[model samples]
Target: MLRSDDLQVFVLTAELGSLSAAARQLELSPAVASAALKRLEAQLGCRLLVRSTRSLRLTGEGELYLPHARSALQSLVEGQQLLAGGKATISGTLQLSAPSDFGRNVLLPWLDEFQLQHPLLSLRLLLADRNADLFRQPVDIALRYGQPEDSSLVAVPVAAANRRVLCASPGYLAANGSPRTLADLVHHNCLRFMLAGRVHERWCFLDDRHRELEQLVSGDRVSDDADVVRRWALAGRGVVYKSWLDIAQDVQSGRLVVLLPELLGEPTPLNLICAHRAHLGERVRLLREHLVERCQRLIQLAPFAH
Candidate 1:
């Protein structure tokens, strides 16, 4: 039988693509990760990884052993969950990832309340705009906007948000003149969000007959950061197409106005995603439930009221 500790370390290292990254996730040193891998390889009498200064690659022998090791680890984890006393009491660290703006405006405030309710539990929250790889990153759960592309991860729709609308400060609109039609957008400066080498310069709208109209927009300013785009709009730099949750305050306060609300299309979904662990732990389950409940309430409360 393989040592559980060694198996755990090996699996983590494989998932993370590097021993150092795995060590960081496990809160261990790089030397410790290397030693554990060496021990694991020694016990099996086969080299599992082709290691280099920069990256790790699994050997053919290692690939064959990986599935079995993963299954064993999962079974062990599930067994522990079955032995846990009850659902009411859960203790462990729950690592989570979320978009920067959502985490700041919506999630961070509720965390205090969640912590107060479950004093034994700890949390590690990573707020980023880009999608975090749960399998590679060791995150227990992630709050994400839009459907998850990874089939391996389980996604639960936690909330819903409308697609971005063209918005600009009243001052800017007054100076540049509000667009009367979709075609007029070409004449106005449009702020864009560039993600993964794709710039969202084409604005999609609908006519009175509900027919789709695609407008190609251009501007001098563009960024991947939603907050940055919102700021630029607020500063009267250009018209921004932003998520409603992101610009709710500006809209409510009359600082910004939705340029073409009637033409805006369907709402996009927000989801809570997690790696498909064989045994869903009590802490993970509890946190998932808590987030779903809180998000529901947040949607109803309209906390973005400006």
Candidate 2:
């Protein structure tokens, strides 16, 4: 029977592409990591990897066994989490990837509160506008907007009623009157944010007759970070199509005003995503529940919900 530590070292080495790098990540000596992998190969009676002075590659046999090894480790993790000796302190690092704006302005506070509750648990957060590669990235969970098209991921809808609210700063609205109609949007300076690599200049909304409308709105500025767009909108730069949860406080505070209530924009799903089905763990489940409850409150803050 191969030790779980050996399996862990093997997986980390494969992912990081270097035994020494994996050792450093695991906080183990390079000699120990190399020895563990050697022990694993010895138990299986085969060389699992080919190593040179400066390179290492998995052998064909190693490739065949990799998936099974990964599956086994995942199962062990799930079992440990689920079968914790009653009331065992849930302590481990939970790494997450999130969108820039929501992560900073929203999730950051929630996570801080959670950490306070679970003083033993460590957290690592990566904030960015781009989607993280769950299979390759060192992330346990991800918070995302919109439904992911990939069938490989498991996504739980945390906030289903999140809609984009058209908004402009009071200063901008006073400087250049608010849009009263969908057609009026063309007359105002629109703000845009980049998604996945393309500029999302085409704003989506519902017409007065409830027909879906897509407008190719142009803007004087565009940024990959949604927070920047929000800032620009607050600074009276231009009109912005943003999630109500994102701009609710600003709108409620009267810093930003909603525009064209008749033109209802589409709702984007807020999801908590994971790469594999490991039942996630007690802490992750509770975290999901906490986020759901919090997100529902934010969703309720929306001035218009359909």
Candidate 3:
């Protein structure tokens, strides 16, 4: 088998575009780095790098092998981490981001329970309506609604079957009268929220006919805070279209009533998002499994979870 260090030298050299730079990063001398590269190439029976004193570049064979080499290194690192911290002791600060409403209302208690179970684990939670930049932000994972737009991000399902629900407080329906049909929403006060600097006034759902419909709604109140919208709905001020996980307890407690159960709501599948699969360490995987169980239980308990 090829020495892992040699593979590292080659990968780092390809990435940094300098054998000397790769050597500096690995704390190896220039000669040793060069020798490692030669050994790696010799084992593969190909000239991997076109080298000169002025510049270095990968040959076609080197370009093809780089990704595999990187994957091998990453696998090695993951295996080491799994063995070192995967057991009874999980000691690390897990930084996470989540939506303001779900984070505060739902996820907070669950995380508390998780921390209680793993006493050595520390957590830093950021609750905001806006999505966190996994590449730039300090957050290691994010609990987000809907699928990520950026295909590069890894989205592991926490609640894949979760969907939005149109709901209102009993008092609100009693006073304003219930909307019997999709067109009747024009007469109702549909609560709205702002995200990514835009007001989400269009409520999307499937009609009784199973056709996709987008209802442009308006209300007297609007806020960027999602909890405020749910609160407004609870206060009987307006109707809300929100995730079932966030409002399941409210619905179960008779604080809010699901509307238009005949019409299918837009899918808002929740996911634990990360920048790469390598970020799904043992802790993250365990957390995800925990959430999946909790979320599924809540969804099943609700009157109209779908």
Candidate 4:
């Protein structure tokens, strides 16, 4: 029989590319980690790693076995979670990624409340403007706006009705005046943000006849960080096209006013996304439900501009 500890050691070492580093992560000594690896090899009757003083690399056999090892570990974990009644067994670290604006202004407090509910669970949050690569990065889940372009990933809708809204600070509108028509945006300073290394300068809208309209927009300021653009708008620098969920509080509080209330802005539904269906543990399910409720309530509170 293969010991779970030995399997864990092998997987960690393979992933980290350092036996000592894996041991440190597992809170075990280097000797124990080495022994576990040797014992695993003895059971498998093959050397998994080609170790050297300078580096560690997987052999051909190890390369073939690594995916199987990961699958086995995942299965074991899922089995444990299932037997523990899911939510009650949610005890491990839940690594999540989100857009910087939402993560700080919105999710930070929500997660704090969630942690309080599940005292046994731990959380690790990564905040970035770009999409997190679930396969390459250590993130387990992510909260994102707009439909995922990757068909392989599983996306659970948190706010299907959510849409992008054209907005500006009261101060900015006061100084520069408001855009009454889609064409009027070209005359205004439209704050822009970068997505996937490209500046999102094209703004989309729906006409009063429900026809699609596209406008080429530019601004005095641009930022990769969505929150920075929101700040710039708030500072009376330019107009911002943003997710309604991200600026709900600001809009509700009368800080940011919605600009073209008649025309429909582009839909940008929010989703709780993960790389695989198997990764949807009980904690994720509960968190999704919690977020759905919170998001819907806020959406209801915001003035419908689009």
- lDDT per residue (tens digit) for residues 260-300 in model 2: 77777778788888876663666677788888899898777
For model 1, residues 136-252, the per-residue Cα lDDT tens digits are 455667888788888877777766643556789999998999998888888998989887778988877666687888988999998887667777899998888766655666677
Q: What ranges in model 3 sit over 4 Å off?
A: 1-88, 302-306
Q: Which stretch of 10 consecutive residues in model 3 shows the poorest summed lDDT?
A: 85-94
Q: Which residue pairs clash in candidate 4?
A: none
Determine the C-alpha RMSD for candidate 4 after optimal superposition of all C-alphas.
Answer: 3.3
**Residue pairs with backbone overlap in model 1:** none
The TM-score of predicted model 4 comes to: 0.86
**lDDT of model 4 at residue 147?**
73
C-alpha root-mean-square deviation, candidate 2: 3.4
* 1 versus 4: better lDDT goes to: 4
Q: Which candidate, 1 or 2, has the higher lDDT?
A: 2
What overall lDDT goes with each candidate model? 0.74, 0.82, 0.85, 0.85
lDDT of 4 by residue, 1-306 (tens): 998889899888987889999999999999999999999999999999999899998887887676556556756876787877773555666779999999999998999889888888889899998889876565778999977889988899999988888999999888888888889998999999997789999989887799998999987788899989988888889899898889999998889999887777888888998877767767788899889999998888654532
The RMSD of every model to the true structure, in order and in angstroms, is: 5.2, 3.4, 7.8, 3.3
Pitting candidate 3 against candidate 4, the one with the higher TM-score is 4
Weakest lDDT window of 10 consecutive positions for candidate 1:
297-306
- Candidate 2 regions exceeding 4 Å error are 11-29, 41-88
